[model samples]
Target: MRTKETVPEEALFAHHQAAMEISVFGKSMDVLHKEDFLRNEEFCILVKLRYLLDNGIEEYAGINESIQLLKASIEAKDSFVIIDQTESRFRGGKQQQFYQFVEGLLTDFVSTEDFQDRLSQQLRETLTQIKTQEGQVALRNYTEQLQKLAERPLALKLLSLFKSYNLADYSLLRQISELVQQLSKKDVRDYQSLKPLIVANYRTFESLGKIISLPPQRSNPDTFMRMTQVLVLEYKYQLPFVQLANLLMVIKRWYQPYQNIIAVREQYPPHRYEQPPDFQTSIPGEAIFLKYKTWLTEKSTGVLFLDLGN
Candidate 1:
């Protein structure tokens, strides 16, 4: 029996690791592609042009002139050189015509306008597309169900935090649903049994947040260290020592920098800056615990307990 249970647990763990790797890879690729696009002169021109159009700047002459200049710069293999040379020419007492023209084009392109109509149009298009997609209907229904289930005062508070921080995910909703189902199956349940499950669920969200919000500069060990400290403090009394130790080990492994720490430190020394104080209550674990406590208190009546926990 032990072996059978352990095998499934190990398999689930492996599956989770694989999913994390895929998520990381997708995020890295997105960052790389964005950097590449930003560096491309054509892409830069189009983005500026899109901004102009979105802002209702349809001056044909200004737009055409700007496009020609950008295209010429691209052909010369140095788009930024035009901006640099134009500035230098102006300072050298040469003709200011080119510099003024380019400057005006850029200035007018970014000038703001009321974008309410454009925003409304975008929303209508999005709604139309969502209505056409069959899967989106199901997704919307699921979201509605989640919102309803989250209406309990305790759950509402936690849900609001999760939404505010972009911490909520489909997996979290699924986990909550499963927990509720398990509780329903029990012949007798109480605060003690439910408390551990809530803690476990919150811990999962904390772990996911740490993984998803990993610093771009992985050489910075401070984030991982802070995560370790919080996890240890939060779970030390609540969980078995062995389990806590294993969780810490997992965090340490995930936090390993892609680059060597020695090399990174040598390249970038510490700066003399005042660091912000760490707020312990802001951590998901503490917030979730407090909300759960509030929920327990609010539903303390024996009848409420009998319906849900008994």
Candidate 2:
């Protein structure tokens, strides 16, 4: 809970105490290996130091002096705990290498931990917004949040996470797909160009379903949206069609005919209609008619269908 920017000095001192207590004995000095002991010390020290630096303790003097003090604290023997195979004559040559390694460790202690801390903070922040006690409801709420904000890039990123993880459910997939479609609205050309992203999100869901033994209901729109978002990210940015087909198959099987009728009607031109009033009574039957209708319409726009009559 102690963020780099907001951690109190007192709390960090407490963490120092806690890290010190991690040894078998309740003190930092009890550790037998000087380097290993310092390594443990370094964890808390680095965290607090970074916290201080983030909060305007910009003086390099204090931190640099602390580093020196830490280095001096290491026993000479512990600094050169090299393998027995090393020749005694080469000890002097190894000292320089040891110094370089220590310096690199110090630098790494500062930069890598700091980066990880920041990344953890960002992840927690984003996850907090999306996660909910209601589980499925929470996912739906998060998907709706992205939709409302029109945050296509963030949504895409989340979608990738969901899909690669196979977090797709019926509700989740529908919501994620809808969000992608929403992003494609006239104002957001960048989002329109993200069709591959949209497709990829769906594909991740499919892959996840195959690998992980999640409940089939996880593919519901709410669950699928979150899962697909995760999945889209997992496939190294490639969208898989097999998953998309599976998802479409699920949707086709489960979706109400009325809803499909509405979608088909919207796809058809206002002046044109399909042949035979009851042509779409069965699921596969409807799919075939719709596919043929789509192909013919593409070939001749509305003219071919209109000329044929209902």
Candidate 3:
């Protein structure tokens, strides 16, 4: 629960503890590797050094020198982490690469007690660069595929619907995964309202002998949404559908913030909406921009307002 700014030493000390479970910079480290922590000799060295640093002991195995190596990042002739204080979002800085650098620190430490101890002077300076910069473009990029998908029309449409496409979560797919609920609706509209139509049609089809009678379904909006999607499959070029909570598994089997969102969804299942009169592909962006909002900076300019949402 520590804010990024105030989370330095507590995070270090927390990692030092034996539970081997803690969150660092918004990412959780589970104790699945707890057994390994007790046996890893290399990890003991690093973590013990961290313990000394945090307690202000001013010594590591009494050597009074930094044993921590700058092995990850290499420069032209030698290896070193980039110490750019000014490189950040919107400044053409490699914020994504920097995030990976910080992520690498946690990744290495966790695999090793599976974790840490102290905020050393150099560490304090390094952690300063790290905490405020997590998942900054939604902590950005998944790979080359992310770059390709991010520039596509479909990615824009999906992001438009989800609303919280972070410049922090860079990978196009993880951004999509985080907001998968929005895509699961089956309303043939945003996919939330399908029960009445399917129920009505089921009875009608049965009465007309177009289909045989069967036991009632364990009825719910979710069921209705799936049942009505076949219609949209037939809609073809005019695909207007929502798959209400279809990918709830991917959403629920995640870590925090997401677990919080899932808890809320459980407390209140997807809300019901009237079945749309007809399927129509949703127009992207705020209607006000399309229908009313005008160009800014100058009223006389004829440019329409654009909602290039994340």
lDDT of each: 0.32, 0.33, 0.28
Residue 183 deviation, candidate 1, in Å? 1.4
Note each model's CA RMSD in angstroms. 30.9, 33.7, 30.9
| Candidate 3 C-alpha lDDT tens digits along 3-90 | 2222234433432331122122112112122334335333333333333433435322321111110000000001000112223432
Residues 1-310 of candidate 1 have per-residue lDDT tens digits of 2221122344334434544543453343333232233343332333333334334343321233222221221222222232233334334221243233323332232221212233233334444444345433433343333333233323323333333455534354345334544543442212233444545565443433432333244213333222222222222222333442342233333233211222333333334222122211122122322332233232434211001111
Tell me the spans in candidate 1 whose CA falls farther than 4 Å from its real position. 1-122, 125-163, 195-202, 205-310
Residue 244's lDDT within candidate 3 is 12
Q: How accurate locally is residue 112 in candidate 2, as Cα lDDT from 0 to 100?
A: 36
- Residue 5, model 2: lDDT of 33
For lDDT, candidate 1 versus 2, the one ahead is 2
Error of 2 at 83 (Å): 63
Off by over 4 Å in 3: 1-87, 90-107, 111-123, 127-171, 187-310
lDDT of candidate 2 over 1-310, digit per residue (tens): 4322333445334434433332222121122112331233222233233334334343321333222211121211121122111222223333334323322332233343453343334434444443344432433343333233222222223333333454433343344445534542323212234445446665544444432344454443344433323222322212322332233333333334324344543444334533233323333233433442343242533522211111
Cα lDDT for residue 124, model 3? Answer: 38
